[model samples]
Target: MNHDGLRFGNLDYMQIAWSEVTPGEVHASWSGHLTACGESVIKAKPVYDSRVRDITCAECGATAVFDLGTAREKAKAITEKYEATGSLSRADAVSLRETALQTIAPQAFKARRAGDSWNAISSNYLMSTGAATETDGTSILVGRVGLAVIEGLEVSEYQGGY
Candidate 1:
């Protein structure tokens, strides 16, 4: 059926969410999918409904958005920082992961084997950041040169490259 001159027959929702890093701009995300979902941009069509402004995803009738644009830019800055200083704060790593997910880049990566190579070794990013501890182990969220993260990585193995 048609609602307010917008058709819902296609069932493509641009559901998204974002935060105001600054005013007059927004960093948006389409949950993981969007109507015109592209690796670079997101598009939200107005349904003209006061109750539900944008039908990004028809989740039995629910929706939202995210800031992939701002996110990618932030990720780039973080990557650049890591490259220049070979160091990233825990916050930077988290930002990278967030943008990487939005940009469709490799979100899960390990430090390159301690050598001349910049290539990151693939590691398990499925683990929670909180799982690791200072005494028992380090948090995979440890800000390192390689966005270092691990699953059950013992404190002893924490020489810390990736």
Candidate 2:
């Protein structure tokens, strides 16, 4: 049962199926809980070259489409921002994260300082440090700030387990 390079192993977290009767048309189905806060039962038929399609979540009444290129671009931009700033305000962090959620599913970003609380979340994945090496190539005090992307998003929720 070849499925046009689609495999359940790629989406072990959800129940998924597909029928490839025609050469370029594939009908796919998926049902499972998302990593964020919703249940999903999605059906979609996309031609081989299709770039966008919608999926409605049964648990949260949320309807969204998956755009892989856009999501990757957004993620890259967000990552570059963090790499440049090395730190972010709470509002900026949250806003960037929300923007990521618009194109992707169940994404989390986190930033923290050495002595600060870790209660905020973002949508981009990045990490940085303030530590700088001495001119003599000696180790110095470590940096206090850090950033990271926590991966729990259910790509299968939108990809029909692709």
Candidate 3:
């Protein structure tokens, strides 16, 4: 464990890595960085560090992730595509995570209302609900973002209104 009490190989830690294999992505990123490799998810594995300051991959000499369209737009298009063709983009599953939470459980939706003690509540909820990340909030790694669009909210906005 380093100064922050984090160690390599911590699933709860998003490991900073050089993109030796691909572009616009990182290795073992699950340390809860919302914008990781444009994937929006980090798989829990061995790596180093946990502080947010080191979250940027530019430090590793890799191209940073491009924050494309908003989640709502992507969800809409994703659902339409699935409806017409029945195909899914597993690579884009991270986009559906928050929207799905808003669709399914509006009460705990962090985008709208995150009360005090959110970490405790979110951690407990994530573990029990089989959420993808160990971090707080409803950052679920949908793994198949299209499924949530087709099945869950039908690509509707979760927070305020569509």
List candidate 1 stretches off by more than 4 Å. 1-34, 38-46, 50-64, 85-99, 103-127, 130-162
Q: Write the per-residue lDDT of candidate 3 for residues 5-123, one digit (tens) a residue.
A: 13222333445543444555443354444324334443433445533233334311111111112333455654455445545344443335444434333222221133323344344
User: How would you order the candidates by TM-score, starting with the best?
Assistant: 1, 2, 3
Per-residue CA lDDT of model 2 for 1-162, tens digit only, reads 111223233332223223233223222233332211222324333323322122122111112223333333444455456546756555655555454444223222112111212232321222222123233211111111112212222231243321
**Distance (Å) between predicted and true CA of 49, model 1?**
3.8
Error of 2 at 15 (Å): 9.6
Where does candidate 3 have its weakest 10-residue lDDT segment? Answer: 59-68
The reply for model 3, stretches above 4 Å from the true place, is 1-95, 103-105, 109-115, 132-140, 143-162
lDDT (C-alpha, whole model) for all candidates? 0.29, 0.29, 0.35
Model 1 has a clash total of 18
Candidate 1 residues 1-162, lDDT tens each?
011213122224323332222222222233333222222223322333112222222221211212233333444544565546656655765665553343222232112122322232223222223332333312332322123221111211213232
